[model samples]
Target: MSAFSAIGDPEEAEEDEFTPGIEPQPTWCPGCGDFAVNNALKKAMANLGKNPDEVLLCTGIGCSGKLNSYFESYGFHTIHGRSLPVARAAKLANPGVEVVAAGGDGDGYGIGGNHFMHTARENHDMTYIVFNNEIFGLTKGQTSPTSPKGHKSKTQPSGSAKDPVRPLSLSLASGASYVARTAAVNPNQAAEIIAEAVEHDGFAHVDFLTQCPTWNKDARQYVPYTDVQDSEDYDFDVTNRQEAGEMMYEVESKLYEGEVLTGRFYKDDRPSYGQEKRSTGEMPEEPLAERYYDEDAEWERCAEQLIDKHT
Candidate 1:
C-alpha cells in the first residue's frame, strides 16, 4: 500500500492538484445554498497555506456527501452518520494531516449523534462542518434533527411533533473546543469561520445553514440569514458557555431575525487528545508502510506473534 494509505503522503500534497475533477456541475436546485458553501470551503482550504492532499475530507452520506467528489483532497465518502468516527480515526492515524468531516444535520446530529458527542470531548484536532437545511434533501423531504417544530415533511406529514435539534447549543454542551455557525450565501464569512475552525487545535464544529429548495422550500425565509457582515457583528461569545447558551436561545426566539450571529461561538486552546499521546515533536521521517510493515518478512513474524498471543 502507498504511504498515504497509512499516515498520508505529505510529499504528494499539491495545491494545484486540489482542483475538483467532477465533470458535471452539482445537481442541486438553481437557488440551492450548497453552491456557496462548497465555494467557501474551497476558498478557505486555499487560504490555509497547505497542499490539498494534506487535507482529508471525510463526509457522510447525503446530498452533502456529494461534496467529497468536488474536492481534490483525499476524500472518504462514508456511510450516513459515521463521518465523525472515520474522521477521528483518520486524524489519529495521521496526526500531521488536517481532517475535515462534512455532513448534514440528520447524518451528524441524528444518526451519528454518539460519535459527535464523544469526538467533542476527545478534542481530536479536526473540523466538522454540518449542513443544516432543516430537512433531508437526499431522502426527498424528510424531517431532520434541525427541522423546526411543526414543520411538515414526507417523513412527518402531520407536522413534526418533536422539537428541532439545536446544533449550536448541543455542540457547546458536547464540549467541542471550537464552535461556530455560518450560512451558505455568505461565502466570505463562511470561509473566515472555517479558517478559524481549521486553525484551532482541537475539535472544531461549524453549523452551516444552507437552503434545500427542493425539499425545504420554506427555508427561503432564512436565506437572508447569510447577510451578516463579519465576525464583528456576530455576538459569538467564544468563551463563557453561559453566553453561548443565551445566544442560542435568543437566536431561536427571534420573530424577524435581524443580526443573525454567524461566527465563532466558542473556542479554547486545550491540548488535543492526539497531542497528549505524542512523545516526539515530529513524526517519523520514514514511511509508515516501511517502518511498521517491514518487507523482509518482519511483518509476518509480528503478525504470527500477535496471533499466538491472542490464541
Candidate 2:
C-alpha cells in the first residue's frame, strides 16, 4: 500500500477525528475571522474523509501560525514566510502525504511572498490557504502588503502609499493550477473551496478573506459577499485563463469598493512539480521514507550505515 493510503481510513471517519483530544480553548478575539478559517478547515477535512495522520499542515508565524496547535494533524510551525519551503520538503520526502500550507496576509503575501510565487509557479502538489486580514493582526494592527492603498495603520499613519498586491492575479501569473478566493464569513464556501483545493493534483491557492475585527474594524469582512459561481451576474468560465484573470481583476477592485466576490476563479490540468520530476526520472516513485525499512537499501543508506558498510 502507498504510504499515504496506509495513513487514511475514511470509511468510518468521524468529524471529531480531526479535533485534538486535548484541545485548548481558542484565544482569538470574539468575532475574529480566524475562527472561521479554523472551523472551515476542520469541516473540509471531515467532509473529504481525510484522517489527521494522512495530512501535514505547515504554517508560518502570525496569528494564522497557531493553526497547527488547534488542528489534530502532523504539523510544522515554521518561521515567518517559510512555511511553503518546509511543506514542499515534506511533500517531496513523502509523496503520499497530503500537504497544506497556511499563513496570514503579512506572513504569506509579504514576508513569504517569494516562496508563494515560486511554489505556485512550480505547481507544487499541495494546497496553500492564505488568511488575508489585510493587516498584521498578531503584531497589532499594521499596514500589510494586501492592505488598501489608503488604509492607515501603525506603520502607515498617513495611509499606505503603494497599491496592495492583487493576490489572485499574482497566483494566476505564477502558475497555480487551481486558484480561488473565499471568505471566513461564508464558511460553506470556504470549506468547499478548501476541499476542492485538497483534491486537486497540482498547486491550489485559496486566498481566504479573514477579517480582523479588533485590529482592522474597517476590514473587508464588514460587508456582505457574493459567490461568483452562485451569482447570476458572473458568467465567465473558471477554466479560461483570460476570463478568470478579468474576473479576478473585478473582484480585487470590488473588494476595496465595499463589494465582495468569492469562489473559484481558475483551474487547469497541468502536471504538478512531483509528477514532472518523476516523469523526467529525477525522483523515485516510492516515498523516500520507505527506504528506511529496507536495511539493504544501497543508495539510500544512512551516513553511518554507509560508512560501516564501506569500512
Clashes of each: 0, 0
Each prediction's Cα lDDT score? 0.76, 0.90
TM-score of each: 0.83, 0.93
Q: Give candidate 1's whole-model lDDT.
A: 0.76
RMSD of each: 4.3, 3.3
Q: Give a tens-digit lDDT track for model 2, residues 218-250.
A: 775645889889889999988999999999999
lDDT of 1 by residue, 143-233 (tens): 9988877888888889888977778778878889898888876777888888788879999999987878788886653545533234344
Q: What's the lDDT for residue 108 in model 1?
A: 93
In candidate 1, stretches whose alpha carbon ends up further than 4 angstroms from where it belongs are 1-17, 22-24, 226-236, 255-259, 279-311
> Candidate 2, TM-score vs. the true structure?
0.93
User: Clashes in model 2: which pairs?
Assistant: none
What lDDT is reached at residue 109 by model 2?
90
